[model samples]
Target: MSLQHFSHQHPLVFIASHGHEIEKVNCSACGELVSGSSFGCVECGFYLHKQCVEAPAEMNHPFHRNHNLNLFTRNPYLAGTIICDFSRKTCENFVYHYSCNLDFHIKCALFSHSIAEKKNVEFQDISRIDPSINTGNVTEELKKAECFACRKPLLDSIYFSPNCGFYLHAKCVDLPAEINHLFHQEHPLFLQFNSQRLSCKICQKPQGPEFVYCCSPCKFALHIQCATIPTKINQPFHRKHPLILQSVDECLPCQICQETTNLNDFVYFCSICKFVLHIRCVSSPLIIEDKLHHEHSFTLFPRQVLYCDACGTLGNYVPYICSTCGIFVHKNCISVPRVIKFYRHQHRIPHTYFLDQNESEPWECRFCLEEVNTEHGSYFCSKCNYIVHVKCATKNSRWYYEVDSTETEEATDSDEPVDLREIHPHNLILSGDIRDFKQCHGCLLPIDTSYCYCSQCDFFLHKACAALRAKKHIWFHYCQKLLKLTSGCIFQCCMCKYFTSGFAYTCDKCKERFCLRCSLLSDMPKCEGHEHRLRRFTGESKELCRGCGTSVHAFICKPCNFNLDWNCITLPLKTQHSFDVHLLNSLITLMITIIQEVIIVIFVKRKGIPNIGFIIV
Candidate 1:
């Protein structure tokens, strides 16, 4: 006999026994196993149990009351796969779709049971743990262990599960449908699965399951893991007291790495000493095997150190020192890329742990235009004479590898001529004549060491200046922009009133010019010699250099009344003087001459010698 069924359009036939040959057949209506006598269509292979074929087409489910639920054997939305809202699992069988968006498993929609209504639900573990706890799961020992919600490992002792081996945290199972979070106080956060691939606000990283804490109205979503980070804790790095988690509303420098904390993330704050540390920095490993340098491992130190071998800055912060290589680097510096396409250079630049001191003159950085101490670590080009500071190369993200890096040759600081499209149409040849000083076009400072200059156009540039990128982001500038190098006009820098006939990064819209020296250093720098932080003083007032005693523009410590000039801070330890060509023996001869002059002048009434000037001593 043939009978019409709601699940299929074709007529169904009553099959008494299909035998054991058809070992498995499923009910199309409720998606259950079919056995014994069943109703089926031979042509379409649509089978259903006798009771399922008699079920209603539409029904009201207690869990969702806004709309009537419709049974669907196939996904109507054509989204390929759908998630069951009731069971919080991927649905492959029959589903009940409501309001054109909400989907539920057939079992959850018809035979619904809230977490509280389930008889197997346990409350023994939830009562002991703090209600507001953010992290860690209740302890459990099971052969096949899984959390009730996330289905991940539960390492702590604060979870509950219905099955003997399976478990989940009480917090995850008991999360309210909606909540008000301190980080996002403006809107109410709702618990839902993120099907839109929204990024998490706290970690700034995206890649996870569908379940998340979300604010549908604002489209703000955060991963469940980030939302559960403890608000306060005593960190192992700084263990004096509890470190409270604070939002980054303003620029606050991290005490461990000494870099400004990103405004989007949370930081551990110690209000008593104004100490702040980034979550990543606080969790840095004591010993790390850096990827770029495979020769030796680096160990972290807690005390403040002298100089950073990477950025070449004097700051108080913890450093990662490699005892085998005899080098000290900031924790953040360890993450600098081994090979980078710097905005300022045409070829790929690889980081060098040490530059050979065999060069006639010191190599200066192309971006900052500062002397690159060969004794420290820096990025160098093996193909050409190009070198840059680790921090300077990464300041802006403009210089990224657009093409395959393997196609380009390695960079080197060689004595080859370079062609600059911004400068004259001719290639500028490298000159290593220290005796002849030519004003550089970029910084407008006299180049006393190595330089690249065009004999045809009378254009000159410090080897460093010639390597400046077409576009860059300086420390003082708020945003990155294309820097145009221009000359043939007298320009005075707005920050530092220095007259420059050489080239500079010119802003035609703002009518501002910035020399290379002023662009390298930030307004606020922590100096090794000063007790308080030093601020760059640009006013045209006389300030004595604390080290050299020369009156000029200098960085000042307002509280201590101490000032240091750029020339004083960057002075080389040893220098060759014109008066003393004979090294150590010349100083002794000069002392003897001074003593004889003193004897002759004191013992005998004598006038000044012919070529000898008045002896101030």
Candidate 2:
């Protein structure tokens, strides 16, 4: 018999299987197990459930009603993978395919209709939103039930079907299909079932086959709970200001815990100062385990009562204390390296929780050059008498932990040159020749051979200087270690009793001068501008340098009638005078020419020797 259908040519016959004789098979219409009465054809092996065969051949879904959808038993594409456009799930059985290339599962279409109709029949007794939703008495058996919509635990007031024992969360039933969020402003996010297990970009949570707010074109997904997170929040830890949620494009570490914020996760930012905190770091555990510090668990305390055992400074906030061993440490000090190879020490130093007071000699921290309290935490070396305070060892950008101690301490040149990112633009070569006339650009100390140098930039750094962590907590500088430029002036070098017009590293907290010559550079050759070999002449003399006619203090030059001062000898041959528009050359000739013109005037003025120390060079 002819019947109105989408795919079949002839009408399917109503067949049934006797309880003892007929075989069982799956119905093609709904892909469900069929044993009893079924509408099917034996010739083509095509089958359908009696109820599925009665389903309409055309449907107008509430979600997409631009055009009527034709029911297709098999994928119209015939071979390509067909996914329901609405739920983004693989289409298993019947699909309502429209001419506009849209497809949806039969179940999803019915759910859409139920949602559009605002079905509240089952939830009439249980309010959708109530303040006492979680306060109600719930049986243990019913507490295990999950919402049918989101598949989450039915903790909130939910609608329950007594007959089938089906449950649905009140919030899940009322969730909107589409929404616009501030984080993803480019497109409207739609409620979709994520089967690919893509991670949410906002909270960095993995998205399972659950309802998530997603943007199809951008491929961005956020969990429903994560999407509803407030834009601003005030936690007890930071009550002074309300933290605002913001997008961070860079890897910025949280100021409190020193843990970096994920680029994908939202950050609670404070615009007033350079303060940033990670969302996860806000509610840090009150008690946690630290294997490196103590054998027992640590309990976080509200106030700082004493100096930190790790850094030896009075903490600014709460600190962790081990009740069993009486070890006090800063929260930021938990991840300190267990073993480290410092530039000043030859042997590998390991972290020590307590020092032996019975030792013959008192323990001294080599970093600060001060007596270390044996009761506190510090890095120690038993082979050698090396000890360093926790803060002194791991100060911002100080010690490098990127390489293993064995490999970093190895005296081998097989390793490739490394590019010191923000420190220098060129690659630095490792050199261990303190005998060479070179200085480190970082510390301005002589390269004793254990140093890194860049020939192109004329830069040098002690191996320790090269391995310096980008951030550091220097004892001399009050603020953190920050690189700064030096104006071309006579700024006295802090370490060496010399003057430099070159760059000096400084910080915001202190003006402690540190020139590269004193920190990194060592043995050096004669000055380039002067003709004679200059020496470090610190002698009591009323002599003058004829080069600029200035008093000679300490200089590097061969003995001549005209002694050249250190600054005059090191002057660049070609210099641009502020008053002059062009670069001037032949400085020696210019001085001689000026002196020649003065010599004629001196003769006429009747000069008797004129202290004759000054002469044209």
Best by lDDT: 1
Residues 309-413, candidate 1: write the lDDT tens digits.
766666656688888777788877776676776655555677777664468876866555457776667888866678877767776675544233346554322
**TM-scores of the candidates in the order shown:** 0.46, 0.44
lDDT of each: 0.62, 0.59
The deviation in Å at residue 280 for candidate 1 is 5.0
lDDT of 2 by residue, 1-617 (tens): 42434556657777765244436667776565777776766677777766667667787644442456788877888588777654556887888786566776765555545664676454566444332554565567566766655666666554554332235666777888888998899998877655445688777867554667877668788888778777898755455678888877667656556566766457887666434667666677898886654457877775435566666654344467777766667777765677765644545677776654458676656655457876667888786666877767666464534234445555312133323655577787887665534544454333455777787976777786566433222223323334354333334466443444344655446677665443333112355544654444433564587677877564533345446554455443443233443324234335434654475446535544344334221
* lDDT of model number 1: 0.62
lDDT measured at residue 152 in model 1 versus the true structure, 0 to 100:
54
Q: Output the TM-score of candidate 2.
A: 0.44
